[model samples]
Target: MTDAPVRTDPSERMCPSTPKANATVFLGMITPAGRVAYVTPPLAAEVALAGLPDPTEATESRYRLAGPCVTSSCGFWTGDHCGLGERLVASYQETGVPDEAALPRCAIRRTCRWYAEQGPAACPACSHVVTDAR
Candidate 1:
């Protein structure tokens, strides 16, 4: 049998092709209240099954479910690495949260990486808990 590709940690895979900060985008899951709850790669199998919101149909009213985080807070963040966490923090800080009443349905519910990683639990900051809508 042929050998499978070497499996690298998420941090090592942060920038495979380029050394620039914007070379690649790291995925993260935030809350409806504009807080970064989790961060990981998009290709993660668990992410694909946790159910995320559709970017096309996503409205500003919807919670920012997945996106690139700035490098500072990213698990892979480093001086020589991309600034994904910094970018995410900037974006989140600039945008803030949307109106709670206008939040839209999550499209990636079955494939959300954060949900799969964290499971249904209360958010540490707001104490808001996540439940499977399905």
Candidate 2:
């Protein structure tokens, strides 16, 4: 039999590392030591942006953001899946993907693009990513 395509709920898919224009959900802050510390219950990115007097404080280097997943528009979209999420999970598999119980308390897990495509495996790898490394 031919392979059946897996259907996903596309309406709510959230891109975990979106640009400021697309960002609506504040995912978390990148720590001083360079690890992502997730924020739960999903805060609006505008609230976080409003609190920052300095524009630099709103940078991706300091905070992670999430927004509506724009497939094809994004470079990481591999037609039906997120190429970046797949790569991150594959690379991190050498270490280990966390159990569901051990995944971070993320703001957008329910609709997160990486989580939706890669399952719990994406979380551990996602925790270490910075949207803007500079």
Q: Rate the local accuracy (lDDT) of all candidates.
A: 0.32, 0.81
* Per-residue C-alpha lDDT of model 2 across residues 1-134, encoded as one tens digit per residue: 12222222456799888878888877888898888999766677877777667866688878898888889998888899899999999989976867789988987787888898899999989988989533
Q: How do the residues 1-134 of candidate 1 rate in per-residue lDDT, one tens digit apiece?
A: 12222233343322221112232222233366654343332333223323445534322222223333344655545654444323433444434444544333332323333323332221221122221112
Tell me the TM-score of model 1: 0.24
Worst 10 residues of 2 by lDDT: 1-10
| Candidate with best lDDT | 2
Candidate with the greatest TM-score versus the true structure: 2
